[model samples]
Structures are given as C-alpha cells and as structure tokens.
Target: MSNKNPSTTRIVELAKQKSFNTEKKVLDTIKSMIKNKKVINYNTVAKESTVSKSFLYKNTSIRKKIDMIRNEQADLKNVTNHKGNTSDKSKDVIIESLKFKIERLEKEKQELKDALAAKYNDFYNNL
Candidate 1:
C-alpha cells in the first residue's frame, strides 16, 4: 500500500543535486559528524543525499589518513617511553659519579694524613 506522492520524488531529486564536489561533500560530512558529536556512516549520507555509497567512498576514503594517524600516535608513545628510560639512565649515572668522587676524596684524605705523620716523626728525631 504505497501512497502516490509526486513531491516525494522531486524532493529526493533536489537532495541529490551536487552543489559541491564529491571530495568536498565528504569533507563536509566529516565536519558535520564532528559538530554533532556523533559518528556518521557513508551509506546513511548516501541515503540522505542520494549519492551512491561506492562513489562517495571512492572519492573520500580516509583509510590512509587514519593509518598515518595511528602510526604517528605509536611513534609518540615510543618517544615518551624512551625519554623516561633516558631519565632513569641519567640518574644512575649521576649516582655512580657521586660515589666515585666520594671514594677519591677519602683516598686523598688518607694519603695526606700519612704524609703528615711521617714528616712529624722525622722532625722530632732531628730536634
């Protein structure tokens, strides 16, 4: 039981009018989804705008861009992890350097004390 509506077909035809190029329409659709804060499907856009789903997809497929974005995010995560590891390595190096400096200072102090005792004994015998 379909109602005979003449204006419905006309309305659908107007909706199918190409005011913008295929790529621009796809980009606009992406922006609209973001503005509405929801995900939209290409098939739905096709139903609304009367453009074929295959054609829309062929013109504005974001698979490559999405892949690149994912790769970039992974790289960022790796860099952050590397920086943390480097910081830990730097702290270890600093701790080792301070320990070496302390040991060297202690050895020098002991040498000076021994030299002073030897000099004092020789002077007392001579006097």
Candidate 2:
C-alpha cells in the first residue's frame, strides 16, 4: 500500500488550486483581450495572456472561439475590400473633379478682381 501523508495531500490540493486559478486568470485575460478588439490568434493570445499555446489548443471552447473570431475578421476584410474598390474609385473621381472646379473658380475670381482694380484706376485718372 502506498503511504499518503496528510501534509502531502494538503500540499497537492493547494497546488491543484493554484493551477486552476492560473488557468482561470489566463482565460479571463484572453476574453478581455477579445472584448477590447486586440489580436486573437494563438501566438498573440499566448503572449498577451501569458498562457501557453498548447494550453489554448488543448482547451476546445477557447480554441473554437478564437477560430470563430479569426474567421469573422477575415470575412469582414474580404467584404470590405470587395465593396470598397468601386466606391473608392468613384470617390476619387468626384474629389478630383471638385478640386479642379474650385481651382477654376479661384482663377476666375482673381481675374475679376484685377479687372475691377484696373477700372477703378481708370476712373480715378479720368476724374
């Protein structure tokens, strides 16, 4: 029969509690990071949360959540890119056209000012 000391049993229980606490803390940190829109990949989570990558992979719920978030981000990027291409081109064209119109109007305003100044000089000379 194996000998089991009371002190040794208590020590083992304490160690298990510590391990569970550490895992819970790390999981909470990971959730907070996700809520804050920080990176959610294995390496980033492991680095930011001080949790091992192996531990994250071994935990099925955490691994699934990370994968789902990553996939959603990827899908959002693709959709944005597809929609933005056409809109961006049109926006660029409109902006350039507006800039050209403003430049032309400014030039016309300067010409009118110069003409008015010349006419005033002529009127003063004739007076």
How many residue pairs clash in each candidate at the backbone level? 0, 0
How much lDDT does each candidate structure score? 0.64, 0.83
After superposition of all CA atoms, the RMSD between model 2 and the true structure is: 15.3
Name the regions of candidate 1 deviating beyond 4 angstroms. 1-86
Candidate 2 at 74: error in angstroms?
2.3
Model 2 Cα lDDT, one tens digit per residue, 1-127: 8657535878899988976886777778877987897867889888887878998888787788779988987887788664435687798888899999999999999999999999999999999
Candidates in order, TM-scores: namely: 0.32, 0.50
For candidate 2, list the clashing residue pairs, or say none. none
Question: 8-50 in candidate 1: lDDT tens per residue?
Answer: 8777766567534655665666557546644345555565445
lDDT of 1: 0.64
Poorest lDDT segment (10 consecutive residues) of candidate 1: 60-69
